[model samples]
Target: MKRALVLFNQALRWHDNLLLSEHAYFDQLIAVVVLDPAEYLTEQYGIKRASAQRLQAQLKLLLDWQQQWQQKQLVLHLRIGDTTSCLLQLAQQYQAQSLIAAEPTAPEQYQQLKSTGLALRLYDINSLLQHQLRPDLASLPKSFSAFRKQREPELLVQRPLQLKFSGQFYGETKLALDTVSADFISRYHTPTAALLNEAAALERLTKFIWQQRAVLHYKQSRDALDGDWNSSLWCFYLANGSLSPCYAWQQVVDFEQQQMANESTYWIRFELLWREYFRWQMRQHNSAWFSKNAFRPPLDFSAPIPDKRFELWCKGQTGLPLVDANIQMLLHTGWMSNRGRQNVASYLIFELQQDWRLGAAFFEQHLLDYDCASNWCNWAYIAGVGNSGARQFNLIKQALTHDPHGDFVRHWLPEKTTAGALVHWPEAKVQLQDFWLPFLKQLKSKA
Candidate 1:
């Protein structure tokens, strides 16, 4: 009897899952998810690695999977502590023949699993295409545009696997719900948080692509700060692997074939490609991406020692109306719009004059849909310390363009609203007009 232990992070759903779909291959299989101790520890910025929202989402996801597998008489083990140690301990206890799991994108994570020296097999469950890019780090493209331009014409998105756990399997373990700390739950509960599960994820995708037909106007409204029709909100699912990118892509292709084929339809796929680009870049750059001096020639930079100002920004109290509003939204609901993210991140990096890594760590700690490559790379880009060119937002112009009516801002910043004023352009809280505008103008001119 050859048994296998499945260790997965990121790829958590069963529909398009690599290990769960192929359970028949093993005589017996035990699945496990370790709540790494690192997730609970505080970083230099005084924020824990995982917020209550993220922890709650994870708990829900695991519970959902456990209920599904329980009907089949299988058990999913949920443990806490170091990732590598947990997997090995379980493997030895089960006397498993090998480890089966989805490949990890972050280099440290990938290396951690590989270093176990146990027979391990990993799958690229995160990617849409069946054929992965060759493992040639040095030969990879230098930029995202080049990668997309060269690959989009030839990329093939595979159909999702239709799985059936028909074979006889292990059925002896007890099922139980692990206790999530009361303090954690009490501190992070928000009435507006989205439910985390495969059913909810699929429903969101269906609504966005077909029922609401929001894809038709995604190109135009994607930057809007509020409203469901503005964006798909699929990142939460994609980041956690409850939704499959390939399945989403196939749906878009089907939509175009049956409905109308336009830039909006193609735009969704373009965004997916950007995600793929980051994954590939992570593979190429390895762990170096996390280093402050990862860039070639190293960016000439300095950040003020994190102080009260930095702390205020995190609490959404910096008092710049637009930035404060976005941060407040994120704090209240574990989510924020793309435009909001860009604006707030830019303010943290340039306006607050704080360290970019600190901001990245804060997001890593708080964001429910956080992805290593995307989150860190974006911070590096905005901080002018990435391989890709820097992006600096003109906050004044951006607020005027996206929230001109003040509906988005007012919803999050009611105090900023003036009863008769046409727009809620609140005065800047800090006195920086003397140099802020000219510095931004110079940066824009250079770009």
Candidate 2:
């Protein structure tokens, strides 16, 4: 019997661990993804529950994977409870001589995963620049430009590695679709294996920004919240480890060589480095990143979660256009663009003066790309609770600046209007049929 070498991660949708596994380099390869049911059920220390959207997105990605790689030995292990121990049990079940995974992004989870001593090979897909850039960013950039200034000059955008995981597969798939959560599997929806495979990640990196309508005009337009392609959707893919930051950087390099270059293109890379800095911060701070005393401070995060406020915010009824629109988009689809997230998070944390963790929980619920390191750390930063000291995003100012015309606000909330209020984002409102009545029908047909 070829020695079994299995791989596991929270969502194996091309996350570092699976990327290595896809090389098909193991004999009787056993692929597993164990979901901690507790993560969803646990309240934000009693701040309502994190949105279930997170699990749904995972299921969606998994179903897409199974459709294409049906022959691959993917043991979709849904550990309803005892997630860590379940992983250990799965490794033992297959007699997995070696366990391969990505470095942990969360603190307690890392400690738990590390407890297993089955020859673990933890890799660096977790960091954008790997180990090289983080020490330089320990004092994570207070602003994007400063971070880029410190690191971008040295970034080589290492050529993509086709690290193959070769050998016999398909000897151990202990579980199946019938045994797992059916509702969970249905949430993720993508049309093609091209959508599920690593190729999808690479394609998104190239085509999402540079190819069609590049972010070259992003600096001015990124604040134009309602439009498409204004910002790179790289965060979603990067959060899931679906897309590699370096690969995306290579595309940026390609763009500079072959296409127009500007602040927008540069800004996109800058965000990638920003992401690296946050991950480095996560390693440095651990659980403290999410706490109120986060910046060595004086706030109680364990306070009771305000249900009414949380419900209104999550359901997109915050009376703020950008906030409502972004939340609605996230609810309907298990993803939100970066523009929407920043606006929404600001409203949840600063405007409403609600807890940042409550907002983070909601995002964790729905964001298909919810990376704990980036999401919470960012929420903390914008809420002025992050380790990088004080940084706050004002809600009203953000709206006036980003959606000056109110199209994005109008798209999400159609009935209300401040005629003289939005002088710039003025698209003459055609007497649209009762605001989204027609739009809802259209969405249903597509879904």
Candidate 3:
């Protein structure tokens, strides 16, 4: 039998998966998902590589995919252990001839997959632009503007593959979920109203563009600190591969043609391009992307041994109201706005003068939409280590501009009842002085 083993990496869904198309030729296909334990272990920075919330979210996606495959009479075997070892065992057990999977963006995972001496077929289904069309790694642009200028002319989002498998299926293996501790799940599980699946992803795209007509104002409101419609909220789906960027791109194109073509509609594409830039950048830098300096020279910098400042920052006890509020929001909900992320990241890297990687690690732990490239590259960019060096935000200016009325801060920090602009400056209110004075004085001394 011409059997193939299909591994679902980042591209979790079945709709646009190129790997599933191999079923047409293969006599029997084994679908598998391997969850590496290394992903859940705490790193040297004292942060889990993947947080409980993110793990839980990923598990939900896998479970949903399992049901979808069952409907088509295919089994998605869930395995937990070393990915390479699991794949080899399964391949040998099933007597598979070839291994198929989506191209992983993370350097470690990418290298691991390549080291497996199997007849492999990998496809780049996660990105908006196809892999072959991208610039050579050696010649890849260092800045987003240059990248955009180069690729915009030839910009083409290929149609997602439509694969329907009706061939013979491989039987099930032992489910690994039974091995997962209930304590781990319960610890990280915060009930969310959002559905993390392909069907829900499609429904969201339709509702955001067609039903609410919100994409029309996306450009103007994308920077807002908080709101349901301010942003497209597509990042959650895009990060996990529930929604293909090509599918999203086509939806926006249809919206522009049928309704109205404006800056708001175009800005959505612009943001997607930024995401594309980071993905390619990660591929170019490889292991260096995760380094402390991140493709840049290390500076003479050392944080305090105990790193009390970082602890305060993580807990939302920092004197800066805007930063603290955003941190609190992220801790509670596993999400924050783009504007909030930039501002808080700036505070962590510049204001506190802590290691930028720690801030990135914190985000990786808490952010529901955390993509490895996007998270680490962005931290490096803000810290002057990545492309387009050192973009710092004036915390007070940012708060005044984005949250002029301090409604966002007050919403998150109910104790900060100081009306109007006073909420942004905790030092102004007598009640907050005890906590604010010491931090403010230390900052001034450092300056």
Candidate 4:
């Protein structure tokens, strides 16, 4: 009997139903994902204990996804230690034929997977286009505009419907979802009985963005910090493979054929390319993608010179209204908007002068849609240190320019000004310089 196990890691996603729908074809499918033992350890030591708590919370989110999916009594496996060793052991014990997964981005981890001697089958489950879709992502382009131009023509766009297994190896699964342990899901996740798969992801997209020609307005409003429908909620699903990127692009194509194309519709494609550029950065650089100095000078993840100040930044109490509100929302809900994301990231790397890696690590620890390549590559991109692009946002300039009226700043930062009288208040460069002198010092040291 060629029996195999499907590994489940609640690192950022739960077991994917789109993938699991193919489960019926395998003789025996035992799904598994192991939480690395090192997850309990502090990441960079500056925010050690706080990070450990966030890791636990992320695991809890995954557990919720697993419980919701394991209704069929699917052979779900959960262990908190070495994943490769566990997979190999189970594969040997079952004589499984192949292991199927959406390939991971971490070079060292992927190498470990390559050496495992299993017939590893990687599908285009995450990306709308492959990393090399654009000829030049493989070669570092000098500018974002150039990178975007090179990619637009060559987008290998396609949409494959979610997989549904045919044929029957009608055997019962051994594992049950109840055995999994985690509490954050029960405490906070929004309750819904909808089909929790790629189909559902599509349905949500239609209702939110595609149905009403709303995506036609996306290019203009995507940077709007507070629009609920500002951006596609695709990351969390794409990160988990509950929804595939090809399918997402197809929905756009269908919408464009029926409606006149606009920058908003085109912008969606642009962002998808921007997302792939990061993936290619990983392919071109390999291990160096994880290194801090791949683009600019090395980041200073050493220590927070003013430790209390860093805590204040983390807790959303920096006296900066827009930045504070976004941070608080993330701490409460494991989600944030695209504009909100840029605002907070800008605050960290620019205003706080904190190490960009530290900020990326913090995003990985908390973002429900955490993709290693996207998060770190993005951090590098924004910090003038990744890929070939050298762009960095000025947090104050962004705040005043975008949130001029401070609706975004006050939404989660009501304490700064109870009535938002200063919502459009101009930020003082002196305050920014004084608060972030340590960070500028580090950057200057490298210069």
The order by descending TM-score is 3, 1, 2, 4
Give the runs in model 4 whose Cα sits over 4 Å from its true position. Answer: 1-4, 8-30, 33-42, 46-80, 108-112, 130-143, 161-172, 175-200, 295-308, 388-392, 418-447
Q: Once model 1 is optimally superposed onto the true structure by TM-score, how far is the C-alpha of residue 66 displaced, in angstroms?
A: 1.4
Ranking by lDDT: 3, 1, 2, 4
**Off by more than 4 A, model 3:** 23-25, 164-168, 173-194, 297-306, 428-447
What are the runs in model 2 whose C-alpha is more than 4 Å off? 1-5, 8-29, 47-52, 71-81, 131-147, 168-170, 173-200, 295-304, 307-311, 335-339, 417-447
Q: TM-score, each model?
A: 0.88, 0.78, 0.89, 0.77
lDDT string, candidate 4, 60-85, tens digits: 54555555546644445554445577
Q: What would the per-residue lDDT of candidate 1 be over residues 105-163, giving only the tens digit for each residue? A: 88767876876666888888887645554335577677878888877877767777777
- How high a TM-score does candidate 2 get? 0.78
Per-prediction tally of clashes = 0, 10, 0, 8
Better of 2 and 3 by lDDT: 3
- Candidate 2 residue pairs in clash (backbone atoms < 3 Å): 23-165, 24-165, 24-166, 25-165, 25-166, 51-365, 54-365, 60-188, 404-425, 405-425
Top-TM-score structure, candidate number: 3
Worst 10 residues of 4 by lDDT: 175-184
Candidate 2 C-alpha lDDT tens digits along 9-61: 53344433333444344556565555565666576655434455555555455
Write down the lDDT that model 4 would get: 0.60
